[model samples]
Target: MRRIVQFSTGNVGRHSLRAVIGRPDLELVGVHASSPAKIGRDAAELCDWSEPTGVIATDDIDALIGLRPDCVVYTALAETRPMEALEQLTQILAAGINVVGTSFVWLAAPRYAGDWVREPLEKACAAGGSSLYINGVDPGYSGDTLVHTALSLATRVDSITVQEIFDYANYDDAEYTGAAMGFGVAEDEELPPLFLPGVVESMWGGPVRALADGLGIVLDEVRQRTERWFTPERIDCTMMTVLPGQMAAVRFAAEGVLDGEPVITVEHVNRLTAAAAPGWIFPPDGHVGVHRVVIEGDPRVEINTHVSHPLLDPTDAACISTAARVVNAIEWVCNAPNGIIAVEDIPQAAIMNGLMWRAK
Candidate 1:
């Protein structure tokens, strides 16, 4: 069993923690808690598990590092604190701990994360003999693995598009939905961080490049397009409120260009509610969210994968899937060579082994 340390206790992190606890091949050793309310509590308490796992949540990074875990599931929010997240992951790696995380989506394609973000982590992995793999549901699977899987069926490839269409009405993160996503803001105001120039490329260019790399095609450049939909009336979401004439939905894409043509695209259609965007794409079968892969090639192909749970909403199910993706990679990452491991480096069997198997 791999000894694992869970960092952070947010939505994704919480799911990662429970996954580590539930797995027989993994042992929960320690937790690095970010919230004051979570700190000093048992890790089990943080995720509502009935049984205590003898692991306490602490904000002491050094102390957690000293636990000498085989892997640290670094699920801390990386978008708002990119550099800090890099440094933190570097510190964890430099301490000889492997990492499989959902943060640092750009790291999904390290070549595009720029030298500043790549060099330090590379040096850390070399210095400590540890590996790091970063990914999420969208950047992790939809655009990268799922898209490539669909491409395998095509005899000739023209263009590839991966879409993440979700309704954020039930997603209860105020800062993310309101501030980061600009969901409740006016269109004329300064755009949110997600819509800012170069941001989409920074976050999703990795997957676009990954797709290009898989196809053995060189990209000329990566471009972004963004649009927002206004709410007609007051829309009170679980976490934030949207006023009339405020931004309620967004449609954006990051395009991978080759010879001035976008050959690979990662697009997102996010709305506060299904009622907000009448024209934009919505999840199939009335599901709240879906990751769709559409390939325009010899045999035009489209695949829709929806993740949902009986107890959790569609968004939460996707969050848990994101957590599980990295969490499931822990053992493989621990055993792999010290460096940044990409999603393609992981075999299909290795990724599916954990999800498909059950204790008999």
Candidate 2:
């Protein structure tokens, strides 16, 4: 069995810890956290485990290194200190431990990151003879990577668009809900231009750009746009004051181009109140668009997917599923020809069969 250590106690980390613990081929050796409050607690308790594993959370990196686990699963916040997390991951890899993570944006597609982030990490891994891979449900799965995967079956294509829409009213986490969908903000909030800061684009921009590149298109420019709204009238859940005609909808769109011409568009929309006027423009009702990959060519194809509600729990199952997928691929990645890689670079058959094998 492969021994693994999990870093972080956040939503994704907790879920991945549970999933890895349940796997027969993988053993949960330890859990690490920077927070002083969680150190020395049983790993199971930290993740609400029914059975106790002697493993205790700790902040000691040297101790974790001594344990010499096969790999470390990292799921820390990517927006802040992403480079710092990557530096830590590189250290682990240099210690000859394989690493799987969702922290570094570069792992999604090393080419998109250019040499700035990828070249150095690649060198570090090479020096340690270790391997690293990163993936997640959204940027990892929902973006053009999946679209490009589907396009492999197509003989011709004109344009491709991928969209994800969901009702975020159920999300009670104020920080996540607010920042993610632009909630509680006026329409005219003097925010920076869309995609300039990379907030609205999320980390999936590279996936989209990579997919377009794989399709033989030389992308010249990309465009991003966002719209936000609030409850026009006071609603039960929202406390923000509003007499009427208040903003209550938000939409963010990103478009990829070839030769200054648009070829791909990725959109994310959220609605908090009744699905009304502007709300319709954000997340059109009828279906929760988890993923919509539309290829317009020959036998024009459209692929729609909906993540199971329980599996969609950002804290637990959703991230666990994605992490598991990434973790299970570690062995293959370690043996893969050197240099940077992406999800599509690995064989689809291997991913599918490995997932099935892990399930059993």
Best by lDDT: 1
Where does the lowest 10-residue lDDT sum fall in candidate 1?
351-360
> For residues 1-360, could you state the per-residue lDDT of candidate 1 as single tens digits?
788999998889999888888888888999998778888899989987778988999999999999999999999988788888888999999989999899888787776678888899999999999999998887878977788789889999899989999988888887764688788889788878988788888888878877787789889998999999998889887757899999999888899998988888899999987779889878888888889999999999999999989889888899999998898788788889999998878886786656544422
> What do the candidate models score in CA lDDT, each in turn?
0.87, 0.67
Question: What's the TM for model 2?
Answer: 0.85
How do all models score by TM-score?
0.96, 0.85
Candidate 1 regions off by >4 Å? 354-360
lDDT of 1 at 301: 93
True-structure RMSD, every candidate:
1.6, 3.5
lDDT at position 170, candidate 2: 48
**Tens-digit lDDT string for candidate 2 (336-357):** 6544567867786665433443
